[model samples]
Structures are given as C-alpha cells and as structure tokens.
Target chain A: MAAIKGFGAYLPEQVLDNAALAAEFGVEPAWILQACGIETRRVAAPEETVVDMAEKAARACLERIGMEAGALGGIIVGTGTPHRQFPGVSASLQQRLGVVGIPAFDIHLASVGGFFALATAVELCERYGPILVVGAERMSQVMAREPRVKESAILFGDGAGACVVAPGEGPVTVLDIKMQSDGTFVDDLSMEFGSTLNMNGRTVILQANRKLRQSLTELLERNKLAATDVNLWLFHQANVNLLKQVGQALGIPEDRVFLNLPRYGNTSAASLFIAATEAQAEGRMNPGHAVMAAFGAGMGWGSALLRVQ
Target chain B: MDIRAAVRKAIQDMAQAPLPADDSASLFTGGVIDSFGLMDLMTNLEEILGVKVPDSELMPSRFETVDKIVAYFQARK
Candidate 1:
C-alpha cells in the first residue's frame, strides 16, 4: 500500500574485528572468518544506546526526502535490545527526533522484526502519510552476559537502519507481504530476562534453512512471479552459509542476493534495512521487483515483494 | 543395497570422512557433523536415498545419529 522513499544507515564507530573476537575465544582469526564468513562488526560505544543510534538513522531517512520530523505520521521501531526494558526504543527515538504523539511502538521479533515493521508500515502509511520505520539494536550489549558461543558469539554487532514509507508510489512500493510463525519451537532460539541468550545451533540452523526457503518459495507462488523474475534478493543478514543454502535450494544464483553480513555480522533486526540500503546505493535496485526474506527467533519468518519506482 | 547401507554411504559422503566403527556411535558429539551438515543431509535425501523429507517430518534430532536416521526412514517406508 506504500512505497519506501529511501533508506538510512548508522553503524557505531568502534570496529570489533575478528582478531579481537578470536583472541577472546582463543581461536585463530582465520578460523573465525572461515567458519562465519565475518571480518569485522560494529560495536556501539559504551555510552551509545539504541535510541542514540536510531536517532542518527531516523534523521538520515527524513533528510533523504527533505522532510521534517513533524511531517511523519508515526514511528515504528523493530528492536530486541532496547536501552531499557521499561520504555521501548520507539518512544525514546520519537523524543530524540523531537516528535510527540504519533503512535510509536516496537516489535520484539528479533531478526525478522525489521521486515515485520516495514510490512506493517506499508498498510499504515495510508493513514500515516509518511511513517518512519527503524531497525536498530545494541546486540553486543545484550549478548555480553551470555555464555560465549563459538558459533554465535561473534555473529552479532551493533547498528541501526531506517526507511521512510509514504502512502503512495515514490521509490519502491511493496506489492505483497506474508508472515508466519509457530510457537511450538519457542525455546529453540530465545533470550530470557536476566538470563543468557539461548540458541540450539543445530536446530536453529536446520530450521532456519527450511523456513527461509519456504518463505521465498511461497511469496513467488502467491505473487504469480518466478524466482528468476526477482531483480534483487535482499534477505536478512543472518549468515552467509544459510543464505547460500536457501539460494541453492531455490536455484537462485548467488549474485542475485545482496549480502553485507561479512562487514557487519548479523545486526539482528537491523540486518534487512542495512543490506537493503547498501543494495540501493550500489545501483542494484533498478526499476523492477525485489524479494526480501527474513527468519529468526520465535522461529518467525516472512517474505515481501517490492516494485522499484 | 539395503536401506541401512545406502543411508550409511549418504552419511559418510555428507560427513566427508570415514564413519565410526559402531553404527550407534554419537555422530554429533564426535564432531562428525554440525547443524549445517544436518541441512545438507536433508537437502540431498532425494538424490542420494530416494527419500523426500517433508517439511513436517524434518526434525534435526531424527537425523542426529546414524541409527536414528535409519529408523526414521525405515519407519516412513
């Protein structure tokens, strides 16, 4: 129902390269790189909170269209690692942007949260002309207390990404959006309050592969579009291996998928917008259709079809 | 070849190494394969074993060990 005008990104200044992570884990940097396909990740400075990063990205989003904060009808944030547990990131972000009373809220779907927020904004944009959607998180801080996981510890970094969704056609309009989740596997990938982040690597990896493939396959069928018809594949930056697995299963070529997880690791909810922004800047988003797939905690997953305007 | 032999060869190919002497040995704990390997096994089921692992039947635990994998396919048959 709405078009995404432009995208904005904000990555913390501190770069946590593989060397430092490997040193902490007592493994070779090369091993980490080979195993995870990550080189460096951004870690928010101790003083920088989720709102701080979200503000920068939000400002950039509005600035792209020369729009003022007052022009936005609402703000929707997708984040699991808010600065505080009491007030969500969206409220604080609204205050920082100097906007008040516009129905700001947060979605706690973990990795797929960003895609879910954007999908909701597409429908809400009609009532709220130009809504701001941001996916930001301080993942390093959230996972700090969790036990070191050889497969997951080095997979997260801190960053923020945002997009402006306007009521009518502008830049890229979403044609269709579909989301589904099953609570049966809730504990497979979850984080409890005052408890460490829990992840069953074997189950998570296998299920993620199946779920992502299904999401993309179903989206193409529902839209009456072929997998080859998608101009760009802006999937969640979960991992290089998982992406490759899905791509192969669907017979989608590696070049069609836009990947940036190597430089930023998995930024959780921020992954999609961050990768989508990079793809647009790189001139890959010409006037055509793009498919975005995301899967994460809650065993949640979704797919969206976008038409480049 | 019997179902067990065919499944064993598929597992060995996925592991890309020699199989343990015992059929019931712990493949996951022995570092023979990880989560990624489990996915690879499922995707190749049709090509290697002529088995189609339906989405509902795709459980990581069912394929964790060699004997468990054999039991799963055998039961389905």
Candidate 2:
C-alpha cells in the first residue's frame, strides 16, 4: 500500500540503567535484571514535551529523505503522553514543523499506536501524497517510581520515532497488515488523563504472548509466507524474553528478531519506529521481508508486513 | 492428585523459589509468580485439573491464591 521513505528517532541523553534503578527500588541489580535483560533506558528531560520530541524526530526523518515539512501531506502522531488532551501532539508538531492546511491528528493506542498509524498511513499515502507518522512518549514524566506502580515503571523509558510513508517507493514496500484489540482486559493496564501507569503485569504478558503471535501468524499466512520467510523481526522493544517467546512460537529464529529493550526500555508507542529506524541505520535489515508488531494499552496489537526490494 | 496439590506443584515448579507456608497467601504480592510463571501455571491447570478457565476469568487475581484457583475450577464443575 505504501513504502517507508525514511525513518528517524530521538532518545534522551539521560540514562536510567540497572544500577540507578537498583538504588531507587532498593533491590540489587540482579533482581531487576531477572525481569528483563534491559541494561539502560532513556529518560526525557523534565522540560521536554511529547510534541518537542516529535518535532525533532520528524525533522530527522524528513532530513533523512531530503524532504521538507511543507512537502508532507499530513501528520499522524501515536502517543499516550500528549502535552494536553485538546490539540494533542500531532497538531502541535505540525505547527512546530511550520506546516499548515493538512490533516494532523493523534491516536492513543499505547504501544500499538505507531503501528496503527503506520498501517493507516500505508493506505492514506495513496490518497494524500506522503504522510509523516510519529510515535512519541514521555513515559518517565507520567509514571512515578513508587513501589506500588513499580512493576511497569521500571519497564518504560522515553523517546520519539518517526517515519515517512510515501505513496509508492522502492526498496521497501508495505505489503499487508493485521490489527486486533480485546477490551476485556482494559482494566488490566491503564493511565488516566491525570493518573500514572497502572497494570497487572501477568495479564499484559499473557495477552501479549497470545496476541502478538496470532497477529503475526495471520499476516504471514495471508501473504502465503511463514515465519522463516521474514528476514527481520521488529517488535515493540518491550521485553527481550517475551519477544523471544513470540519469535520462537512463530518459528522465527532469535537472530532474526531485533530487540532494543535493553538500551531504550519500552517507549510505548515510540518503540516500534525507534527499532525500525535503528535497524535501517544499522543496515541490519536485509533485502527481503520484515514483519513488525506491537502490543500495548487498549489491549491493542497489530502486525505490519513489509517487503524490501 | 487433588486440584490444590496439582496447582501447588505446578506453581512450585514454575516459581523456582520457596513459596509461603500458608497456601492461601497472595502469590503476586509475595513476588512468587510473575507473568510467565502464571501462564505456565494456567496451562498446567488446564492439563492437571481438566478445567479450562474461561478467558474472561483469567484475571491474575483469580489465581493469586491456590484456594481461589480451586474455587474457580469448582465453580465450573
């Protein structure tokens, strides 16, 4: 439906590594390491807003492709930590980029927010030239390090990831996508307008294990491919073990799966694009097929299949 | 094996840690079973007790204690 013209991400300079968390949580570093293999995660400065991060990431993305903001047809930002509920991040980011007269909006699907935007952009680019899709979050500001909410607090970091979806480009083609949501476990994970992060860790993991695999399976099957058919696996950078489990379940080898949860932690909506951009820059993406998937609040999950030509 | 015994054994196997002496103690609060351990316990329960917990009732709290898990299974009986 569309091809990713360029991708970019911005990670804050502050480091929240295991040693720092060990002192904060009053637990040894090994205890935290037992949960996830994450060594360090990024934290946005206190003053940085979601739109500000989006602006930086968007500009980097546009710069990567040598395109200007005025050339973009529209903007869609996927984030849970919008500066304010009214205008949201996309409108503010659009203004920050000095563009006008185009539809710019925000979708809050948590981790899958960016994937949903990308899946939608693949189709929208056909109608509206090129679209800028960004997933940005300031998770550190929202979630405190209190013991009660500590389960998810340690797992989240802050950053923004952006990508430009062109109507038709080469080298990488958006082939097919599958999205799913189950509101039954809505209460399992939540963060209100003024509230911080809250979630039943077991429930999130259980659903993520099931949903991520199912979505990936359906997409691969519909395209007459198997897990081995994909050259690279881009996941939401949530947890290494969970990603490994899903990869194993889908018959994808461990090496094929790209994981950056150690360095960036879970950036919610921003994770997928962050991983994609990093992979593209690292030249880890081989010329074949890459399947990217994400799962987050709203109990939403989706898979996007892309072909590299 | 009784339902409690089977569930206890599954939890013990998956936990890889010493459990509370009291069987009704909260596993999640006590940090005995995490997401992976709980899922394994569920799969073990389905096989060990022949009671497939409906997806709707798979909340972590329901299986927080062995007694609650037993009651859930008996409720379906």
Query: Quick one: best DockQ, which candidate?
Result: 1
Interface RMSD of 1: 1.7
Which segments of candidate 2 are over 4 A away from where they belong? Answer: A145-149, B1-33, B41-54, B65-77
Winner by TM-score: 1
Report lDDT (CA) for all predictions. 0.86, 0.84
lDDT of 2 by residue, A1-309 (tens): 679987899998889988988887788888787877778898888788888888889999999989989998989999988888788899889888888998899987788899888887887888888999999998888886343454566788999999999887666788887777889999888876677677777788888887776688889889999888888999998888888777766789888888888888899999998999999888988789998899988888998889887
- The alpha-carbon lDDT assigned to residue B27 of candidate 2 equals 88
lDDT of 1 by residue, B1-77 (tens): 37788778777787845688788887788777777778887776656666788765666777877888888777766
Model 1, which residues run further than 4 Å from truth?
B46-57
Residue pairs with backbone overlap in model 1: none
TM-score of each: 0.94, 0.89
A92: Cα error in model 1, Å:
0.7
